[model samples]
Target: MSNQPPLAAADLQKTQQGNQVARTPEQTLVGFMNQPAMKSQLAAALPRHMTADRMIRIVTTEIRKTPALAQCDQSSFIGAVVQCSQLGLEPGGALGHAYLLPFGNGRAKSGQSNVQLIIGYRGMIDLARRSGQIVSLSARVVRAGDEFSFEYGLEENLIHRPGENEDAEITHVYAVARLKDGGTQFEVMTTGQVNKVKAQSKASGNGPWVTHWEEMAKKTVIRRLFKYLPVSIEMQKAVVLDEKAESDIDQDNASVLSAEYSVLDNAPGE
Candidate 1:
C-alpha cells in the first residue's frame, strides 16, 4: 500500500545487519546462572567453605546431567541453587545432601515448570549437627525380616537386629538423635503411616519418593523426630522448605532462598 519505491539491495543488507547487531543473544540456563546478579547473590549467601564459582559449576553440571533442569523456570532453579549454597549442601550428586527437582506449575498457562529444593535425610542430619546440641543423628529402614521393637514412655528403649534378607519389604523406619547432654530421642513410623504421608504429598509419585523410597521414608521419620531436637534455625527452615516441596505449594517463590533476594522472572537483557 506504500507509494514509496523499494530500497536498493545494499541499503536492505545494511539494515538487516544492523538489526542483527541490535538483537541480543538467546540466554541459556548457564548464562542466566552466570549473570552478575545471580553470582553476587550466591557469593553473599554461600558459606565460607563454598565459593560462588564452584556452586555455579555444580549447578551447570547438574543442568547438563538432567536436561529437564534446563527447562525449569530459571528464577526458581537459581533460587534452589542459592538455597543449597546457603545451607552448604551439594545438590544432585552422589553426596545425596540435597536436590533440585523440576515440577510443572499447573497455574501457568505456558506450562512453565519450577524447581523445588529437596533436602535429603543426610542433609537434615548435617544441619541438625550444626546446632552443636546433637552428638549423633541417624535414620534406618527396618525390613520385614528385621527384628525391631521400641517403647515410648518411662524406660523408653529400642532394639533392632539385622536380617539376611536385604531385599525384604520395608516394615518401618526410625530416626534417633543423641544429645550432647547424654539424652536420646527417637521417632518411629510404620509402613502404613509412611504411606499415608507419601499419599498426602504431591510429589509422592516422583522425585526421591520414587527413586529412593527408603531414604525418603527415613527422612520422614527424621523430620518427625526433629520436633523434639534442639535443631538450628536453618534446619527448621529447611524442614519447612521440604514440606512445601512435598505439598507442591506455590507460596515459596518470594521466601524460599532469603528475604534479601527476589527471584527474577527473566535473565537480564532478555
Candidate 2:
C-alpha cells in the first residue's frame, strides 16, 4: 500500500462531521435542480411559496402519474411543467387539470413533433385573476327576443351550465373582460364562428366536436377577448401558442395539410 500522509485527529474529526451531515430531501433535490439543463428547463416563474426543487418534485410526480406526459418531448414537457408552475396548477389531472397532446409527424415542423398544452377553464380564470387584468367575468346563454344569445359582463349574473341550459338554445357565446384600468373588452362568437371552430377542432383530430362545441365557443370568445388585455409573461407564452396554432390551422386549410393535433384553449396560466 502507498501512503501519502497519516490522517491527523483534526482531519479525522472533519471527515466524521462531514459524513454525519446527511442531506435533506429538499437539499438533495436542490442539487439536481441546480444542473444547468434543469435551470434552463424551468424558465418560467414558479408558484407562490414554491422553489425550484419543489417544482421539480411536483412535475416529476405528475409525469409519473400521467403516462401521456411521458410521450412529450423533453423541451415541450418542461414547457408544460413551467406553465403549470407559473399558474399554480397541480399536474396529473389535479387542480389545474393540465394535459399534453403529442402530435406525431402530422403537425411536426422542421422534423420536430408538435406538443399541445391545455388547461381547464378554472385554470384560465385563475390566471386572469392572478394577473389582475379583469375584475369579474361570466358567460351565459340567454333568451333575447327571438334569438338565443350569450350574455357576459356585470349585467349577466348567470353562467350557462351547458346541459342545464338546453332550454336557452345557445346561438352565440359572449366573453367580457372587465379591465382593472377601468374599461371593458367584449368578444362575441356567432354560430358561424362556432361552426368554424368546431370544424377546425374536428379537422385537427382533437375530439368529437359535437360534445365540446359549447366549451369551444366559450373558449373562442375568451381567447379573443383576452388578446387585448394586459397579461403576464405566462399569458404571453400562451398567446404565442395560440398564434402558432392559428398559423398551423391556416396552413392546413390553405395547403391541404392536416394537423393531427391542435393546441386547444387558452393556456393554463394565461
Candidate 3:
C-alpha cells in the first residue's frame, strides 16, 4: 500500500491553480469569440461570398501571374505574396478576411510584405474568377503598427446591394510567410469555403473544399500537371470484394494419344 495521501481538495486546487496554458492574452481573447455567432455577425457586416483564405489565395495567385512576380529567379521580385489571417475563416466580416503577407524578395519574413496589398470587393471577385479564390489586394496601408490592421473589402464602386453601403468597419489583413524556388512556388495549406450561386439566381450556396488533391477544378495547378488531356476520374460509390481469394477448383488434364511414328528409322535405313 502507498503512503501518499488521497487526492484531496488542496491537491486539486494546487494543480488547477498552477497550470499555465501557453497562449498569448490577445490570442486567448481572440479564441474566446463565439465562432458561429461571429460568423453570422460577420456575414451581416460584410459583403457576400468573401472569406479570408479566398482573399489570400487570390492575391498571391495574381502576384504569381504578374511579370514582376514571375521573374523571380533570385532576381526581380522573387515571386508572389502569400496571404495569412490572424482571424481565421468564420466566413464573415473582418474575421473572415485574410491579411496579405507579401512573400518573396520584398519582405523581411517569408510572406511579410513591406508594401501592402488591398483587394477591393470587385477585384476580389475578379481574382476569384481567374484564380479559383475570392480576394483582392492593394499595397495601401491604413495604419502603422506591428500587428497593424490590413483590410480591403467591398470596393466602393461595387456596392450594388443596400447592405454593402452600410457602414461596415473594414480592417486590414497582416501576416508573414515565405517563398520558395526563386519565388516559383507558394503553398497555402488550408481548408476553405466558396459560395456558388445558381446560374439564374443570385442566392448563395457555400461550397467547402478540403485542402487535398482529390477534390479538383479544371486548369487548377494540379490539372496542369497531368500529361494527358481529359483524364478520367473514377467516383466509387460501391466496394468490390476480393472474389478470387482462393482457387475454387483443381486443374484437369486431357487424355493424349501417342503413335510414335518412326521417322528416325527411315533415316537409318537410308
Best by lDDT: 1
lDDT measured at residue 99 in model 2 versus the true structure, 0 to 100: 46
Q: Flag regions of model 2 displaced more than 4 Å.
A: 1-44, 49-66, 83-93, 106-113, 141-169, 201-203, 207-213, 246-270
Better of 2 and 3 by lDDT: 2
Q: Which portions of model 3 show Cα errors greater than 4 Å?
A: 1-20, 25-37, 50-117, 120-270
Per-residue CA lDDT of candidate 1, range 1-270, in tens? Answer: 111221222332343353434432123567656767557777777777778898988888777777887766555566677678777788874767888887876443335687788878877766665666677777888998888999989999999997999999989998877777899888999999999989977678888889988888888998888767666657767777788777757525424322221111111221
TM-scores across all candidates? 0.81, 0.56, 0.17
Question: What does candidate 3's lDDT look like per residue over 1-270, in tens digits?
Answer: 111221222332343354488654223222222233322333343234555335434434444433233222211111112111211122122321212221234333323222222222222222222221112211111122223322233431111112332233322211111111111111111112111111211111111112211121111211122111111111000000000101111001112223211100011111
Task: Specify the poorest-scoring 10-residue window by lDDT in model 3.
Answer: 234-243
Instruction: Compare candidates 1 and 2 on TM-score and give the better one.
Output: 1
Per-residue lDDT of candidate 2, residues 1-270 (tens digit): 111221222332243354456764334333444555455445335555556666666666654554444544444444445555555555444554344445555343334444455544445555565555456665433333344334566775324334443566556677666665677666777777767755554224553133344544565566676666666655554545443443344212222122122112233333
C-alpha lDDT of residue 159 in model 2: 42
Candidate rank order under lDDT: 1, 2, 3
Worst 10 residues of 2 by lDDT: 1-10
lDDT scores in order: 0.71, 0.49, 0.22
